[model samples]
Structures are given as structure tokens and as C-alpha cells.
Target: MNRWFAATTAAALTGLSVIASPAAAAQNCGGPDEPAAIRFAFAQLPFEPLTGAKWDPTPVASNYDPCATLSTILVTVEGATGSSPVQALMFHHGEFVGTGTAKAHGFTSLDADASSDDTVVLTYKTPDESTVRYRWHDDRVVMLDPAPSAE
Candidate 1:
């Protein structure tokens, strides 16, 4: 009886941890459903018929706090080849808003992070790096600082 009770207790504790892990992780970032956010970003891509395009496994930036009034996430949609232009997608409150104005071309890398609860800073590397800032206003994401044209 003692052996059975100990095993049951251990099993219960393990189950509780498994259940708590996801909640703990969600609180840190990406809200309760990260996959949902990824799917939303993919569907809102400007280029249709995605073809060989795929979303990068990890988000370039995300500040998805459930308790915050606003949250943002940046994801990259990569093309089949390194030289292909990559799209930087933006999401607000888990809803697909739009893509960053900064253009990433020819294997250029892009990264972004939330500087504040309502502001996001994007860094684009086209051999020379440039930064752009966007803010969440009203119900839209607005570019605060425009990036230089890749002319």
C-alpha cells in the first residue's frame, strides 16, 4: 500500500508540472498560442501563392504579454533561396497588421524588438545596417521613423 501511494503521488506531481510548464512559458512570451500567431502571420503575407516560402521557425521579435494593453510580434517569411527577398511580418495583439517597411534583399537579415509596450524597433541588414521604429497607435501600427530607400 505504501509503495502504491508513493508511485501515485509521484505520477500526480509529474502531471502537474507538465501542465504548468506551458502556462509558465506563455506568461514569459508569445501568449497562450504561438502557433496561432505564426499561422496568422503566414496568411497575411503580401505575396500570395506562398509557393516555396516558409516562416522562420523562430520569431525575430515578440513581446506578447497577456496582461499588457498592446503586444507585438515580428516574424520572417523566407524564400527558397538565400538571395530571395525576405518579408518581415508584424502582428499586434496577436492580429496580423502588416509588414515592416524596411526591405531585406539578397540574404539580408532582419531583426526586431519591442522597445516599449507600444513601440517596436526593427534592424535591417543589407550589408549596411539601418534601424526603423514603429509604434502602435489607435488600432494600427505606424512607422515612426522611415528607413532609407534601397536605391
Candidate 2:
């Protein structure tokens, strides 16, 4: 009787509840359901993509905006020195846009030197706008105004 009771108790104690899943974690960093208009602006620092594959791939910023007048850009990278994410507010012709932040994890150049000029790249897509891609250089966020392509 004692052995049977002990086994039952052990089995009950071993039972585990369901916790967060991979799909839930991916939602925070731009999941597939998220809108494409979401934009992310980063500093002039190279960063690796969040791809699960193990290879040198084109690092992409899933959340990026083109028409939105970025006022600030924040960056955060682990295992790197002299390269810090920035929080900048930009004004073009006197207007306001949304805010964003960036982080470079497991990146090669980002891990080596994230502060170098003309290294970081921002990529995003929009419904009305073509795929917007920009590279930071000369201490400036290359602003790309969306224009309708005559097809």
C-alpha cells in the first residue's frame, strides 16, 4: 500500500503545465500576422538577422517604415563593444512619425564593431509602397520617399 501511494504522489508531482510556445515568442519581434507597415530604424551598426538557420545571411529588419518620419532610433546589441543602440527623433519639413528600437544579436560585423559607419541596414515592405531598403552612412538615416512606380 505504501509503495502504491508513493508512486501515485510522484506521478502527480511530475505533471507539468503548458507554458509559452515558440509561436508566442515570435509575435513580439514581428510575426507573420503582423502588418508589413511596421518600421524599425537602427544606428550605423551591422546586425545579423534573426533567422534560425546557421549561415551568413542578409540581416533584415522586419519592422521598417519609409514614409514615416523617424524621430528616434534605438539599438541594442549583445557581445559587442563601442556600438550602442540610439534613440533619435528626426524631423523633415517639420512633422512627426512613430518611434522604434533595434538590436543586433549573433551578428558577425555587429559583434565585431557595431559603431562603424555605413554598416547597418534597414529593410521593410509596405502595401502602397515598394520594398524599402536603406543603409546607414555618413551619420545619416538615408530617407527614402515612396513614389508610385508607373508600370
Task: Give TM-scores for every candidate, taking all chains together and pairing residue i with residue i.
Answer: 0.58, 0.20
Best by lDDT: 1
Candidate 1: lDDT over CA atoms? Answer: 0.58
Q: Write the per-residue lDDT of candidate 2 for residues 80-151, one digit (tens) a residue.
A: 343323222222211213222232222111111222222223322223433322334344556343422322
Per-residue lDDT of 23 in model 2: 36
Candidate 2 has an lDDT of: 0.30
What is candidate 1's lDDT per residue for 19-97, written digit by digit as tens? Answer: 6785665655545466666676666654423344566646555665443434555544553444455555555654556
lDDT of each: 0.58, 0.30
Indicate the TM-score of model 1. 0.58
What C-alpha lDDT, on a 0 to 100 scale, does residue 22 get in candidate 1? 52
Clashes within 3 Å, all models in order: 0, 15
